[model samples]
Target: MMEELEKLMEEAASLAGIYSQEWTNRNPSDPGMTILENLSALHLVQRESAAQVTEHARISLLKLAGFVPLEPENARLAVELAQKGPFSFPRHQKFYVNNVCFETEEEVRAMQGRLLGVYVKGQDEFREIKELKEGVPMNARPFGSEPLTGDEVYFLFDELPCGRKVGVQLYAEVKTSGTRNPFSEEEPVDFARMRWSCLTSCGYEDIVCQDETHGFLQSGKIILWIDTDRLVKEQVGARKGYMLCCRIVETAYDRAPELVAVHGPLFSLIQRDTQSFSMSFGGREDIRIQPVFPEENFFFVYVREQGCGDYIRYAEHAGPGSEEVQGRYYEKRLMEDGRLQICFLDRQRRYLPAEEENAVIVICCNREMMLHREMGVLGGWENQKFDLPPGGCADAKVLCIGVRYAKAEGSTCCTFFRPGTEKRDGVFYTYEEDSGQICIHDAGPYTGCNIFLSDYALSVWDAGNIRFGNVLTSAGGNAGVRVRNPVRGRKGRAKESFQDIRKRFLQDMMQPVLAVTEKDYKELALQTPGLCIRKVSAYFEEKRNQICVAVMAGTEAAFPRLPLLYRRQIERYLDKRKILTAKVSIKDPTYIRVDVYVTVSVIDREKWDIKKVRQEIAEELDDRRNEREIGQIISFDSLSGRIRACPGTGHILELKTIPAGVPGRFIRPGTDIPIPPDAACYPGDIVIREE
Candidate 1:
């Protein structure tokens, strides 16, 4: 019999597996053998194997179907029922049983009789038989009627996951065995079973009712509502509460749609309440419910627990009030560390409030409902609004001034002179010519002049060091001066004459040299650094006026050999001082070949004429050429009368040609051409007349 039962059970199990696979294929989300199917299969197995299976085999068969056998108390009752058939118990008779299993009507009736241990005659023989069908109580009626059993009390709790919660409803049919005899009736007896064995076969922890008396009074059916929240809390602790709260906040942020539609208005509201409220969800609290915008999106939150004082905070935007207000604005700082700090205004300027005054400063950091006020306020409420800070916003107008340095190897370094300024010094210098570049000897007194440069403009000065005011006069005052002796002492009359000339030149340069004062250095350190300067080498070539200059240093060689990077740096430096053009050149790698000659013409065309300007430039070049004996001159004649002369004596003369009736115009020397009634010459062009 046992073997037969086993076979039947195995067959059922196989069918269940097949069904599960089919269900999974149809709906992947929910696929499994339901309790009803399992019970039906169990019933079929019992019926098919009953004749061949022994009692022990029968028990084993039931066990294989995931059912526990009736306990000894119930077993004895079952034996009696089997012997004398279904029986009814007297009023108030009760018994406790363990390891109870019920899959079908027969199994339920068998178990009921075994548990109650009473018998009745004829049709009234079956009294209060708690019908156990499919592991639940069903048809719990009066005595002599179908008894209420496990079949009727479906274990709905079994359907839930291990940790999930569910609600259960239990029904019981209570009936008195005999007619009521008023006072004569023997002490009102409680015929119902006071205690019940919690069946673990149904995938639940054994829950024995210690207060069985109450259970009986409430009828065998007792509804139990179980949820995982309490269980999780009991297992872990308060920490889970915080996590749960965060999850709740996230859920709110994710599903809240109205808040997202009005994000603009919400942001505006938040900005207006910049003081205590770091962020606002417009006038509605809908955003607070959305997890995406708040709990999940915003990294920080202000957490405040009831009873326990703990909070979290985060920083918000701090800037000017809409166009209407001109003062500086301040925002409260919300840092991750457990520190509660508040920012307020002192004399209209933003400042952090003392920690002692606000112990719940950390409360403003949490982005949870715990911090939200019932009035629909979000974010830190302790932070205050005020005028903007002294230094102003990052885009605020700023003045940057500093000295830059350039090395022979084309390396540069820079340093800041004060706050709110950039580094403009220490740039690498690459000499394009054998002769060294001239350094400013003097720049006169330093006025209240503050220098500022855009980021693009600063790139030029980064390669070299350009000094502004020195240690003493950097902050506020006149620039100081220092004179160094010539490289060599005065010698012969010629050398003495050279010495005098050099001394005079130096003196003249000294007039423009800006000096550093001690007070200026002290003030600069106290205030913010001046303009920021960086060191950058020419990494690539760039085109300017159709000429390619190596503006960057890299393997990808492009542009002409001129050290355009250095020239650009110098041009930027001079432009800062409102100086336009300067002479620039590039020396070959070996310093033996002249790569290119460059002249930076910084002319505000509105103030200068090109043709007349060229003539003036020619006169200056001629003077310099006459001073040098080794200069060579090569002249070109064209209709425009533009002359290009390279004096073999180390000088280049560029002359602009004036139009005339003849194709080739005569060029003249030492002649100052007056500006024509209608000046048509462009700057940087050379003009020459017949000589």
Candidate 2:
């Protein structure tokens, strides 16, 4: 601004010389020069004000370029209910930590039954299995080493929830080979392959309700809506109680499921609140309702005319014709103070009865809601501006700003264009998210025209990431029930800020929407929404015009394979982005199993714990397994150095890789293993010995 002011003074002096040279008393004490300086100072202040762009304006500019700020996400947590007997927990039951509220997503019935014994049928005999407790996970394969048709696993519970829905939680041992891809949309269970039944007085009866375990290919909860009124007491492996049996109707499993433990009555929790109210409006006027607790997370607002039996649709802009007002829709926007206001169509497009009509408003609280209000009447002037949050509405993020006005034909039109852009049959304006100001331009013909804030949304930012153990009390009136979150809340996010969105705008624009090259295919596969992908490799088969994309999951398990369901999702995601001539094939990379053996000499036998050293070496090898990529070369020459770096190791006496050099084999001990172009190496086994 100072630079511009100085430039202006120089230009003024040059102009004064062109007119006359007698008034060239350029001293600072001259009256004319003093007035010029004052005007320049005022000009500098105006320029400074113009240069400061507000947050709403920045976000609006980004939107003009097709970039939108993300909305706030609610956090989620898994809660445990500690109670006795069969207590039913209804969905949306509120739990809280002072002011922060968490609600249940599903109904869970607490079971009073205790798992007294576990049994597996073998050669026509029921054997007692004591491997259901902690520290005995790997040894407990509930369906035996090789599960076959007709094999049964029995769970004896001492008590039962009579005639109610019971929740059964299954914890699978981590040593299993299969992985659960959280992003996979394969939710339908293969009910034909498995059968879950309970022993009743009339014999076995089907009791399966909902099975989230996917036939035990992963760890999940199973819900059983059972009738325990006629449940029979069955004797299984020295225990006489009600038996819940899981039998294999058909042998179909990636790996026989191993059970670490089985418990019941698990529930899911989310950070949100829900409320509804009634409001009335008449004569086609604007309506404003201030919430009592404004700081709570507000997600959605639904308005319905009383006795209409349907919700009035929320539209972003007014329709081009007056008939659209009869579509039963309402617009929401933000006032100057940032509070949400609901607005209706103008008298030209819509008319209400003289008597007030009732409208029901349902509020879904996750910290965001629609807001609309009349900005003010516009005058035929240059740079007409209206401030949004003149006093209140602090820390509120405004999502979008739309305007509507009446045309010369007495019909209404709406637009989202900035000033000087081709008018889309409506008014033009710019908004600032930071200052909550809306500036109108090019309003010469529309003097006295009413400017309505047609659309906008507000959200609270980043205050929902509560810590574990923070939720301690139940807000709902369920006595004898205590809730605790075992894991910290996650996925809660604040709305994206103006500066943050700007930094990624160029990079996002540069990303290719169509998969035309190998790099494009790899990037698209890695960006498949909801999937945790560790690595991706794209290979183009020129002859067939097929791009084969191999994906690796972001998991630390012993073995990770791309499930058929996940592969289908990836294929569909890429299919929408590929060219007409290109064919996409989603596949899993081949794996090379490498076993390691080492013998080490310790400096002090008393100080060295060989078991701990071996465990550390195993962990290092696991890290290597996770970091390997397709066609990567594996070398054993660095094995000795890595083992020696472990504490309690003095020297490596012998080191060898499996299949490299056996008793009569010609292979060398520390040979570099060359992998195939489509294969990745994974750790198979590690055997450590002390010399």
Candidate 3:
């Protein structure tokens, strides 16, 4: 700036010299020199003003190029509340830990209703869990040996809990512990999907609140919000009650899910704080309310004007004439220091607040708040964009977004906002997920009216991952229930900022969407929705011109066999991405079992734990299966070394590896076992003896 100012002053003085010979005073003490410096500074300011782009302009340019910002995400935690006896709780019940609050996601009525019985509906027979347990163990397969699409697991409850909601939890003898890729930065996707239906008078109507079981692939819980008022009590073989049937809608299980028991009336909780306060609004056009909490955790903000029975609505854009259809709406502006200001409509827009009453303002900080409304006015600019208030991060989930527009004041003529870039006369906007901005376009007849966001959701990004025992007391402990997170919270993530979005947007432009090569097909299969896969191998058969994709269901399975549903899911995912010329087929890899027998002398009998050594050998082989890649060779030398490396290991007397079920056929001591291209290998059995 200094250099530019000096150059500008010099140019002005030279031009003056050419115009007037008497103007020879150009030194610092001369009054004319000071005037030249001031003019030069003004020129530099004008030049900067012309060249710089405002934030709104940058957002608009990005919107025109199809890049909008993203909203923040709230962290989720599974909370368990314990009481001495049976208890019931409604959704959104708050529990506090160090001033931070966590609310229940669904209503839970714990131990209120007894689980009468559990039955598996077969083609013609209904097998009761108790009857099935007579000869076998406690383990039960409620969906039968091979669960089909129409197969159902019937859970009979003695009486429906208040609110007709049942949080059914399935406990399995074999718990599934999935191991994720340590190097992966991408969020882990659920590989489990199940459909739960309640027996209503009209028949089985789908009612699923939440399922943490990963489609019954593991031992978790499923919450079903049933309409008991319309539920029909039907007899299943011998017993009858309010039956909740879990139908197999779509599955990717390697085998049938086993269960030890079915429990219920449990719900997940999220961290958030809700507050309600009142503010004075005496016909003022702009009213600012600063919340006690940080603006970043802001989830929902609502205001009810004085004497108005209903809360004033919030719109993204509202101009001269837009109040009748949208109804008493207000706008919110985010300040530079992250404070929220509530902006009301002017007298021209028909906003009249009663002088006697105080306006009620309710705000929810943290977690998901539905129907979060914000009002604004469309400036009629091409590709105009509006930012969500302070809490709107790059990963905020927008379930539904629509603009409410009213053309004339008190006029009932208004239209709903559609999503897209189509040139239509009505209001249309597109949600830029990465940028967290809404861009409005083609408002030919609705310009200068109120543009309102009727429905949206806000979350706190990664703040909800609270520690265990963080919540020591319930906000309102009327039921005398104690609460604590038994396990550490997870799945909470920080908000994706706009800077991250731009970087991702650029990187995405260069990322391949289609799966062309063998590796691409493998990756596509690995990313199949609802399934945490271990390994995938795609190989092209030269003669058949067909690409064979073999998938190994992650180590959660005892004997992994890609079921028909999983195979179909992988096939469908790859089919959409693969070229038309390429032939893609999804198949389960052949599983091979290897048995080992070892006899060794212990160096120190007192220090060696025989049982621990045996267990360590078994675990070593299992770990090898998890780490091994497709077509990777299992060396006999490596296996022996692994065994020898065990603690308190002495000299090995003899070691032999045998193919399971193949007697007398043993691989020579030093030879490596060759794995087939489309096969997965795991240890079958191991026998250790002292020499």
Candidate 4:
């Protein structure tokens, strides 16, 4: 019976659930009815339904309550729960809406205030918003709702509007709502009072203050004036007090009071048509004082010394027309070896015999200064009324005077004067024309004997001037001095210089040999006039197969006597013909012969016409040979296969041939005989037939 009753209950509950879902889908205009119906369906099925049915029911409930479900699968139930109340859900109950096709709970909350017309006031309007503090809702009550109840108010964000202007108006209305009395209404509580309270709480007491000083403090405007002198002082202190003095000029006194007041006190002023000023300060002895002025200020100042009284007195006494103080003079006899023998006289005119013969006799004048040069006296009396001796050295030589002057009122007075160059006799005189005072300058010439004097004098005189005067002698001879003469033998024997005998010999002998050809020898001989052949020798041993040709009587005929330089030319020619060892020999009485060994090479050529080659070689040989009618050749004898030559008598000659196969046939015994067919055998080889 109990099982049947349970089945009947379950059937009824299922029917109620299906009816609820149908009602929810049908009521489109009734959002509350639709949400309640969906919730009832969820309550009927507890944990036994599929997840899809649960999700669809929750999404329908949220959408009915104005909660947008972006991820309906994940956020549908969360959006519905968030739209239900302000209470937060458990962590397990809160669904992760990221994977669902529904808006998140945060989105639902964002729509909660937006859908409810809630607005938040920004920081700018918060200063004027007397009722609102940080984290407090702008709208706590409905429009025209009851006045605020307590000192602190808790408000849900959904109670306010969303727009900024609507939020501001709502905030102002809420702040002023309590001003009307619930019993007897006085004027609304002053808005300024609320503002002051807010500002004071924000720690902006000065911002709310009505006092003028407080207004100035919060005004946000600043005024500044620079103290230029103080600034300069500060800079000076920072840089340790070094300052550059400034130059200032006042063009108009009325315009520049600072310059006009300080004129002659801090700085001096000179009134003139010009716009320049010159500064002169400190004593004349102070060298630190510098003059400062514009370029146009042309002026001069007389610098005076304080302790120059003694100098002035001495100067006055030393000037012109004072007195002719006699100078000390003496003559001493000196020997050639530089020994002083005797002093002739003293100023007293008494003979002073030498206590020490070599002693130097120094004569010092009575006056402090003495006249040595003639110009010293004449240069001092330019305008002074002084008498000079007529026959003095000053009359013989010209004098130059240098004078320094000082302006007195509009006139000039000579302050100092001196003679320039000393006279020929070496005397100097100086004077002061204004004082008529005379001084006898030093009588002795400035010798520069002392080291101190030499250095001081060099500083005063230039090197060129000292050199011109011969005061400073050169350490070596002058560059312009002619120490060398180019002309030969004029000043001394020319043999001391090296003679170019080799070059001269080459020019005289080799030059002719190089210029003439073999065929021109006879013509050259005729042109040489008076040609005489003396003696000729083949220098085979001494000069290694060169011919020593000797001729007589004429310079042109002296071919055999030609120098080695010319012999080299003939050797070069013979070398070209492969007759390097041929030597021309001459016996006296005008007979000559050329000795050589004929190599097998000369006989082996296709053009080996021995007659033609021999003629050509003989022609070259005869060209260099001295003039001699008889010529002979001691050569290898091809006919007899021996070395032989022609022997000449006074007119007739006989042929001398050395036999073949005989030891020492042509050469003397122990001499080397050239081997035939050996390339090393030159023309002058001594050929002895092989045994």
Candidate 5:
């Protein structure tokens, strides 16, 4: 700036008083030299202005004494909830705070999980449903008056599996009247609530386990939601003249609410009937706050009670985020969503007396109100001020949670005032978008207190009482309950994430051999993309002169039932690679968990960490991940090696195992103990001691 000013002054030497002699003179002592003095004064002002300008460009750089520049962001998700009959919500739901989504991908059946429902009933609500069990009926009575001899019943199951739903065909003989016979072979008994209709039609009924009950309906088709990962095979008899094909519908059309946050407690809200809304303050930028980048900043959101200013902050439950890798398995990631969140509990079997009307959701975040910027000034309205809109409680019914800004009085888009547009929008709703901040939606109503909210409703209740489905009648009269094959259904495999896909592809390329022997078969299967079940094994049956292969299908979370399709794919691969004329059979392998018991003598117990020893044993024994393969042998050598590999193992004393479902003696050390041909060895109960 000084050099430019000097050059300008030199140029002004050619012009006289028009430019002023102060700028032309280099000496400050000269009487007419005010230009240089004024230039130096202006430099300080410009320098300060430039520094402020730089600070405004970066949000991370800007700071105020009591105000934080960035507001914390909330994690949002789209969630789906279901209900059945009228039931009150739990006083409190048991939730895993750090992570909110269900971890185990294992399928949950009617007998596995119970849903709570609510419906209006003349100023009163009733909890009528006690349990809803899955699976087919096992017993039934002959529906007729009969005198007959030599009657036999046979049950047959399909060898192939359906996706989830199965069409069941029932075949039974019903006579209107009957003559007498000895009721000894088939006893004659009766119950008070004799509703044969439950068995006659499964269409209107929520089929237990989404099974053959649909065939019982006899009318239009009904769909059942399969919560399992996959289905094996199920076949039922043709009962009641209607040949039922118990088939499953793999998909469904459903809508979900935007997930605002994942926190839990006994807070209540006037929920929207079909939809829920989220209020985010940080993800969107504010025009009033200047110097924002074209991009938005990220924040870690935290919560506290509305009235308790200095109370302990609580963390919300979060489904896995997409932003960064987490945990020992760094493959999972989370996206950064800025919003206020409020989660609630769904059901309580214990029955709470608290009324819904008085229940309120009070939430607060460590809000960083932004109102500063550098490049351009917001609210350039001269002599005029704009206020923000009212947020939170809407009509005293809606539970409002989030920050609300004031409405603007004058023109927000232009520098000059525009007439009569009126402040039609809330402060948070309107924005000078050309500025970094983008206006989203109107501020949510104040729920008595401003806050963000949870986007889901969790159905939590007691687990033990739910044992069976609709039928509560006692067994055996003169009737025999015809049963369908107990073939379970699943939720099916989820589409792999990019990280998982990449890891799997890369891992698949790491395998270097073909499948001929058992070891080779196991390795090839484990390395194959999309099919890494717990273990894989190959065995030859000389009688059939063919190779029989099986796989422990599914991921590490829980053992998965291999669908017929996947099993077929495996067979195709193995068939293609097997020696000519050697037919191969690839099937789903059963699992026999091996319980390991050990009491090893260590020179010093302190030297050997018990936890590490157990972990090592698990790593080597557990067939799911590192050590055990699908059909690999249960090697004592590997077990001892794992124990010796522990940091503190000085020596060993004893180790034995009790095979699952089998009651025998322990397998002594040094035994080969190959896993059953159709079975995989899973790590069961472990009792470790230092002798």
Candidate 6:
């Protein structure tokens, strides 16, 4: 651009010189010279149509609130994650990016794999097995119909993976008897006629209940959304209830039946304004959280047989103190070990009874309900040959070998000095340019645990979770934990780039200071990490001092349900500084599922994979989502355009985009689609028929 401007100046100067020679006026004060200078300046300052558009496009409005678009990062090839069984070449796990074949990795204790196994090596042969997609319930529970008005329980799910589908097993033990309600044989309790509900956050509220027959247990699976940070900072629902709650009502029986232990997600299981009694508290008075499970800090109600009704920190139902002080009061203090210690006022208006024993406690904690889980050894690793904590975990993404480390005080240089080594492993200078590309596959281990080693050797260590000192191995070597395979690459950055700073500066010209309004809500919701907001509907419920919100993540065939964790994050953010009279509630949108039908001509039939072309068209149309363009309908021309871009697409032979018969004649041969507020389209919702 500068070079072009310089060339234009030269041309302008040349023309001016010619004019001066003819007019005999070459002075700087000449009117012609002044005209040339002003024209050159204008040319430098002005932008043409294409340049204007390019500049506008480069000013990314989407990068605000620390949003960094993620680019596909390539990992260097290493040992592929293989299912435990007979491993073979031509593995089914192979995937290709940039036309290079790479093996995909998997979590352990999995049945789905490329090969099946046999123990004997004598007649060893690898064989394909049926996919065992069945899920093993990692957690389970039982409930009595006694608290039919939606009872709640709290448990620590320190290792629950967010956004993954999990098996939720729920069962109501049906009484079977010869006469005295004795079960001689097993009988299935029909949850088909029973209504059960569990409180879930964000987009999870839209999960429709599916009835299941009681075999051994009635169970179903759904994607669990856990907002890692919000789950830690805020209460789950209005009354500060359980992180997750389940409520069931037996329309099947007027009389409450025998309840069996089962686990699941239940909607409509909302608790009334009351404290929980069913969920036992597992947390100690000292709210010392594990480094990896630091967010697990909980609040509980402690009751003793001798009439000690002391509560942890929060004593909403405590009696008057010795001197007749009113209202229940409790105290909290941080101990030297960094755990929160709680005590209640005694008759003397003092904190706690000297000794604590036989405490019958009920946990009423919420995570946004326990949203985040990471690799870090808590205060102390349980006694094993290894003294390494989760912090010692080398790569939080995968299980590997090295120990976790942090830089020393006042240290600007990042050094990866291996413990017990005479030399510093190395120092990393550029974390932004070179991180996450490092991988570990397999290496020698002194403890005989097969470990993976990447070429990273040792350099940059993410210090976000690192505190105190370096994690030490049992043998007292480097305390870093390494991984067998890279489980995570670069996270989608939440911060704007340097180039985006100017855009934000310009944006601030129009709007300044965040406020409690729909505009701010929408902005904040989209800015949240791990979220993509297509649109947000924030409706204020004035009477209730509540804000009801519905959010659309994207325009795919079906709505991608928001994770509970992300939902909690939005909720917590709103609840923090919202007007004292304002309470926040998040609800999923009512989806109006519309199908898109397209027709295309095959340009290069031989090279064109018709099915693939159809898919690309579908993806392209989905990508044209603009949530702010309200009341938009599906466009025939837009669909046609996507089809035309397909590798095999010839000019349109006869294009027919369907549902065109809808009331609004808004859709043309395919320009754009209009959608109502908080609506989305998913992958399969698009239909393609080629002529």
Which lDDT values do the candidates have, in the order given? 0.24, 0.59, 0.59, 0.24, 0.34, 0.36
Instruction: Write candidate 6's Cα lDDT for 1-691 as tens digits.
Output: 6687668766877776565567656467888767766787677777564356543355454455443434222232222122222121211122322222222232212111111110111133212111211132222223333324333332222122223333222222223211111111222223213332333444223223443323213222222333332333123222232233233433222223332222222111100111111122332344332111112334543343233332222364344442454434444555664434444544553433224443434333223222211122212212222222211212222212222222234211111212223332321111122233222221112122221121111111222212111221110011121112211122222234446566666676655235478666655554443233556666666777667777654423244455554466557655655666766777766544445555556567676777776676556435225323322455566656666766777777554443322446654543555654444343345655665
- Assess the local accuracy of residue 98 in candidate 2 as a C-alpha lDDT between 0 and 100: 70
lDDT of 2 by residue, 1-691 (tens): 6788889988887787778778878877889888888888898888888999888898899999988987557677665544445655554556666766666656555535556667877787778777775245445777766677887888777777655544454322223342333434532323127788989888889876576566665555566767777788987656789888888887644355666666543457666653212233443445654433334524232344333332333443444654346543555666774345765543454332233343433233222332334467777676788865332222222223333455555545443334334464445665544565766766644567665432332322356676755445664335325666644446676657877798879788778788999889988888775444677888887777788887876544455677665576678788888987888888777765657787888887777877776665554444225555565555565556667666677978777665322232433566665555556555667788787
TM-score between model 5 and native: 0.26
Output the lDDT of residue 214, model 4.
14
Lowest lDDT sum, 10 consecutive residues, model 2, at 391-400
Q: Candidate 4, residue 631: CA error in Å? A: 14
**TM-score comparison, 2 vs 3, better candidate:** 2
What value does the lDDT take at residue 301 in candidate 6? 38
Q: Is candidate 2 or candidate 4 better by TM-score?
A: 2
TM-score, prediction 3: 0.48
lDDT of 5 by residue, 1-691 (tens): 6676666555544564565645555455765556645665576568768777443344233222222222111121111112221112211111121222111111112221121211111223222111111222222222112212222111222211123443222222111111111112122111111111111223322233321111121111123333122432221222112111222232110110111111100111111110121122221122011111112321222222223221122233345542342221111123232222233221321211123221222221111212211112133222322222222111111222233222243211111111222334321322221231223333223112222222112111111112211121111111111111111111222223334444555565565446667566655554443333455677787899877767665432355566554565566655556567667777776767877888877766567788888888777766655645565667788788888877767666777866675535435566756556676656788888886
After TM-score superposition, the amount by which residue 198's alpha carbon in candidate 1 deviates from its true location, in angstroms, is: 5.2
Evaluated with TM-score, which candidate comes out highest?
2
- Superposing all C-alpha atoms, what RMSD in Å does each candidate have to the true structure? 52.5, 13.7, 14.3, 66.7, 26.2, 23.9
Assess candidate 6 and give its lDDT.
0.36
TM-score of each: 0.14, 0.50, 0.48, 0.12, 0.26, 0.27
Superposed Cα deviation of residue 609, candidate 2 (Å)? 18
lDDT of 2 at 124: 78
Candidate 1 positional error at 479, Å = 76
